[model samples]
Target: MTHVSGKRLSVALAVAAVLATACTGGGAAPKDAAGGYSAQPKQTGTPKDGGTATVALTPGLSPNYIYPYPPAAANGTVVARGLLWRSLYRPSGEGDQIADAELSLAEPPAYSPDRKTVTIKMKDYKWSNGSPVTADDVVFSMALLKAALAESPANWSFYTPGQFPDGVTAEAAVPDTLTLRLETAYNPSYLLSMLTLLYVMPSAEWNIARTGGPHLDYKQPKHAKAIYKYLTKESESQSTFASNPLWKVVNGPYLLKSFDSTTGSFSLTPNPAYSGPGESRLDQVDFKAFTSAAAVLNQFKAGNLTVGTLDSSFVSQIAALKAKGYNVYGAPAPARLDSLVINFKNTVNNFDKIITQRYARQALQRLIDQQGYITSRGVYNGAGSPNYSTAGHGSPYPPAFGDRPPYPYDPAAAEKLLTDNGWKVTPNGSTTCERPGTGPGQCGAGIPRGQTISFTLASANAPAFVGARDVAFASAAKKLGIEVKIVTKSLNYMYANYGNTYAPATKNEWAMQDYGPLYLAAGYPSSNTVLNTEGSFNLGSYQNAAIDKLINASTFGSDGKSLSAEVSSLAEDLPVLFLPTPHTLVVWKNTLSGPQSSFNALISFLYTPELWYFHDASGARP
Candidate 1:
């Protein structure tokens, strides 16, 4: 589920600078079937007995919160949540599948004939504490997740009003099995996608509200809330993450070893008691945080970094990198989209009214140079593909978004739109409304005469391309008299504080935001909590009854075309100004040997270090 505040990608997978790479590789470098960067680089070495692998945390993103279900404002990088606990269903890095059946904590869910009841059978897994990962743990997780949402929808991005986990009731019928009865039936695929986010914790060990406190029944709502508060409070102390006993008890392959408070770097050691399928071959995985992409590139050049992403701006350095014994591979991240997130609730300068106008949004979207950004050496640098809809490239759910964009880059068309809407377009000045009435060809309701097409665009400071593209957009908008005030914020700060749903104080502070990418769940990329009217992650409060209906049809109805209808409608409606799907250039040392799936996980904002190990070029343990 893509978050508004940057998560894994950028905010919900928080931000990836919309990148593009026309060049797959120079020579000897591997390539995917599409002739793009290979998801699975060929391995020359045999599996090592045990070795350490250093992974790079995305620039400007650090794991600040340890608790899996932290508030949107408290959520940090996906690395934090993923490394600490295992979700019920692990996301299959393959673009075609929702979950990796073998890696998941539970077997594929079996739905009743009515589709309201789902029975899940747990795998033979155990927490580091040696307790079986039980049905009670699943129920406990659901209870705590519900409690978090009860506090505020801002607590969870995937939540929609009165939806899954809201009206759903769960019970552990047996030690290794659980059943969920939903008040409303959902598409089996959509429900499965939702379950992918349910990370299971050690219920028996974490049921206490205080350190050394007596264990309490977590099924009770009040007790769950108390335990949640206590756990969240404990997560606030960054320095104690490695030392905290509560954090050490894990169900995943790795356990927290040490955490650097200043740099946000952390080390993990294999969980000796991990009962999952993976070898947990790596002795230790070190995640290093950096201040910028340039720094990361420097480390790559110096051979100091093993696994990290290369910003598109550094695409020219690919050959240089490959020559340095590194494998450079990249492709558009699956089920992801980059967009200029507009805030529909912001009434400042009548932006809410102005932006609600279809033509106004079309005009603004037209000002974006998607192709220019992709081709510009300063921007995406031929590393991304143009995207115009919520359902990203190569989506299985066919998009009604035509081959040609509904609103392509055309300054003249943009100018005509403003002028036709009764705005006085000044080529080098502010375009102001001349007609105020809410009638045909007049400025919409509450937009008084003299209203200007101007708004603050909050751009993420990292991933250099984000700012470059934003500046280009602003420059284009300026030609049509749209005044775009550019303000830069850190990627982490944007993910933690930019959205109006979570940060009420910032409601009027920003009109548009570009933090990076919003990653939908793999395989089934539904726009339930993203574009829905009451969506928890609907950061801009974009409301359209028709869109809401379409979203509902896709989410609740079983019609195969429902999602396509939703995606097409969103494409035409311009819910957010969709940008290109940037290719994330994943760079790693050639010595690392693992299944292609492990490297592919990076594209989905998931990390599987337990499956990765360091090996020598000659197929020997390093």
Candidate 2:
């Protein structure tokens, strides 16, 4: 589902829009018969034979410091990768687009009956520079990814723990075809999903290993490990993203042609020699970045861009747009659940002692009144469904999350949790559990008894984050006798140097923070990218033997009824404190179309722009 941020529109999907009563901005589109958006499609007359779609861009609205680390790129990502980087055997509307459904490799990857060692035959496939994307690309990608991890082991640890073969740099397997030998039996599905991040850089072109040049010269056969660490430091800092030729390699359907750092704007075109079936519809997209919510809305009004909603409190303004027939269409956003995690890492910050308690996390969850945030706040505005599952509250895959009851949104239960834990209520409504909860008087001797436990919270503060998040949390926490100080920062600021704040010694400043899972795809009950300490997205650093085992089972185990139940059991215990994961609105010039069908709740909006062609000046949907 797509969304207009300001006013929540129930975007009903349709082909063409009818005539409008007037010409203006700030309104909602009249809902059509099928319950989709019906509007007079913005007319871009004199449509050329296809030049460039500048994509009035917002380059960094996602606020990520990195360019493409499974990080969200505004129009840039969709334009560049979607057009430039075409994966081998990638997903499509009907079937696998890159490779035939019949797994026809030379010998169909020599599998060791146990399915651990996959000997892939890279007879077909070529990179932008015309080099065959061999097993070496795969091996190189895995090795570089491993080296990429070694750069900052903690940050990249979640995806592949112990992925690096010890001193096997010479044997890291850069060759014509990849013969991946796993220590344990890995599921076929896990190997396929790994493709989401498996960007095979041309061995000679992608230099994550060599020192200078746009991308670190990863082609340097020897220093494969050292260069990855250096390149990652550059990647995280958005260092030289524009200058890197390695970054421009074609893997998907698009490639980055030009990017402007100041405007946060960029343009991309279809690769000429690219071996792919799909070609981009709009050759150019003018992307215009906006700093504040006001700037985003203002651009929409001026007709510089096409789509938008009242993400800010301009609820009334959104109504006005409908009156004038702006054909405003919107969806809340893709369904996601926002959550909070008490960083288990060592820290002297406030709440370090309190957060360690599992019950303490549960207690905080109960106090937060997640229901109110879901219902009253209208955070999703209207397009989204409130969620309670990692797989989502309701239907999708195999229904991993049974239709169980939502978490207890009871404040009273929260209070009992605090009181029963020996937290005494002071004159000022706040409660304080004795240090260590039950320690010698010395545990209480050093720290103040009634100083009111100070809790620090940090969040991305993205558009959806601004007002909806911290406010409700602050209000809920205070009622339960906790003094929480909210720290709102930019997305770029938070994912500094490495995906974490500066460091525990110099930068980490929160007891709990708004957490966005570094997870790439959405799945049933299991997740390595979710639970693996080696993944870039597993931000919370949560660890439990039972939880880890179940997640592994979910990832590698068969997708079955029993596996589904395990995920539900984990959620009940609040693996991470559940909060409302709100929807993200994609606002474009009304001229933009053909994106919704490509939405894969698992991947970003970068999937199918090749099929994303536009209508003639006649403004036809087809």
lDDT digits (tens) for residues 107-168 of candidate 2: 23455787666666654655666665566555556566555445444333234454423222
TM-score of each: 0.92, 0.73
Q: Per-residue lDDT for 429-464 in model 1, tens only? A: 888999888888898888898988888999999788
RMSD of 1: 5.0
lDDT of candidate 2 at residue 98, scale 0 to 100? 15
When summed lDDT is taken over every stretch of 10 residues in candidate 1, the lowest stretch is 19-28
lDDT of 1: 0.79
